[model samples]
Target: MEYADSKCNAYDTYASEAKLYPCLPPVVVPSAPELIRVEGSAQSYRLQKINEIQKEIATERDKHANLSKKYHRAVRIVAGVDNALVVSSMVLDATGIGVLSTIIAVAIATEGAAFG
Candidate 1:
């Protein structure tokens, strides 16, 4: 009974010491070459992503430029049509006035000849 009691006391002391000072497992560190390889892969992935973004940016810029050119061309065509319509209206007005004036002159000459 005394021997069993001593063994129990020793276990209790060990448990108390373990609680006060905990022992953590050893940390496994990676080798230098393994760390370098991992870093290189990460850098390559980032560069690839950057290149893809740049390509997207260039594509968008091309689309924008094309749209701008089309818009300018449409504006120029509309302006030309408007100018042509204005000129045609002026020509029609002049022709109508010329016809009316000739008829009036003929009527006045006939009236003077009949009176004389």
Candidate 2:
């Protein structure tokens, strides 16, 4: 009985001297409603930015289309003028007039200067 009592007392003394470590507190979290509101606002902002980008792309596409149309029209006009020059030169050569060669040379030089 005396030995058992001594052993029990020693255990109690060791238990009292034991060191305890502190634990970190749990992290705080937002409620469901608050989370929903934050997410909704973020989503709306993203959507608005996407729409702005889309509008910019559409505007650029329209500008490109207009430029393409102007370029094609200019090419057609140049082609028609070139054809007219060829026909006039042919008619002058076929006539074989005395001053026709000089006139043809002047016409060709003028066309070259204007185009080049």
- Residue lDDT tens for model 1, 27-53: 899867545345888999999999999
Which ranges in model 1 have alpha carbons more than 4 Å from their true place? 1-38
TM-score of every prediction relative to native: 0.56, 0.49
- Quality of model 2 by C-alpha lDDT: 0.79
Q: Cα miss at 111, model 1 (Å)?
A: 2.6
Off by over 4 Å in 2: 1-38, 97-116
Instruction: Assess the local accuracy of residue 85 in candidate 2 as a C-alpha lDDT between 0 and 100.
Output: 100
Alpha carbon lDDT of each predicted model: 0.81, 0.79
